[model samples]
Target chain A: QKEVEQDPGPLSVPEGAIVSLNCTYSNSAFQYFMWYRQYSRKGPELLMYTYSSGNKEDGRFTAQVDKSSKYISLFIRDSQPSDSATYLCAMSRGDSNYQLIWGAGTKLIIKP
Target chain B: DTAVSQTPKYLVTQMGNDKSIKCEQNLGHDTMYWYKQDSKKFLKIMFSYNNKELIINETVPNRFSPKSPDKAHLNLHINSLELGDSAVYFCASSWGQGGADTQYFGPGTRLTVL
Candidate 1:
């Protein structure tokens, strides 16, 4: 099984809707969790970052990590068309190397 | 100003040819990374350098090479490119090698190997 698993969803939702994107990993050693947003033809950009099992909120985005279940989620409130992009979840063991294991991104579309 | 930048934004090369992608960061970061995003949009780290020293090297083929001449520059050179080499390459930089360090990414280089 892959270390990280995420549904590659082209999930479509109306503007102002709440969107949830999630990822699950098999490794319990992952301590640093991150969410990245990638626009078409562009590189992935860091959106949200959280350490260990907790929730971090920034603007309309919230990142939640549950170490017990090896799950992570990014919640978007009042989603906008500008939010339409691919959401990727990444995690690392916080080791000296700091190598990240990535999830296959889920494509999200916010309709007007 | 762009924190990270890559040259040759788009490359279309024939199979068996050799090409290179250059990455530079003005962020004065100590760590730099090279990642490959396949057609399925799965990102995989190929190599990483910290302070111009190789730190992380994945199981990539020898045909792929990464060079770090300085802390701000990491270049990837691909020899004998195959059709499977067609993918978007990204360069990222961080202040440190710690896992909690936030990575800043550059505009990707789209390589089309035909």
Candidate 2:
């Protein structure tokens, strides 16, 4: 099994609808979880980051981490067409020099 | 001003040829990294440097080498590239060490080895 798993979904949703993206990992030592958004033909841009478990919210976006279940989620509320992008989940063990283990990104499309 | 810049936004070369992708960051970051995104969109870390010193070199083949002559530059040189080497290469930089540091990525260079 891959260390980090995410569905490569061309998930479609209406504008203003709430969208949820998730990732599951096999490594219990992964303490830092991150969400990155990548537009077409561009590099991944860091969106949300969290340490350990719990939820962190910024504007209409929220990131949740469930360490017990080895799951992490990124919720986008009132999505817009401009929000359409590939979302990548990454995790690291938080060692001194951390190298990220990234998931196969989920492609999301917010229809107008 | 662009924080991170990469030359040859698109690279096309024949198999068995040599190529190099240059990366530079004006962010004054201490840590730099190279990541490869395959056609399947699977990203893997290929190499990392700290202040021009090699820190992490992943399981990539020896044909791939990362050179950092200064803290602001990290370049990847591929010798006798193969078909499998065709992928998007990204250069990233972070302010410090550890997982907590936020990495800033450059616009990737898409390499096609035919």
What lDDT does each candidate get? 0.94, 0.93
TM-score of 1: 0.98
Candidate 1, CAPRI quality class derived from DockQ: medium
Backbone clashes for every candidate come to 0, 0
- The local lDDT score (0 to 100) that residue B81 gets in candidate 1 is 97
Task: Supply the DockQ value of model 1.
Answer: 0.79
Model 2: native contacts recovered, as a fraction: 0.70
Model 2 clash pairs are none
Question: Model 2, B1-113: lDDT tens per residue?
Answer: 99999998999999999999999999999999999998777888999899888888889999999999999999999999999998999999998767568889999999999
Summarize candidate 1's per-residue lDDT along A11-102 as a digit string, tens digits.
Answer: 99999999999999999988899999999998888999899988999999999999998899999999999999999999888788868889
TM-score of chain A of each: 0.98, 0.98
TM-score of 2: 0.97
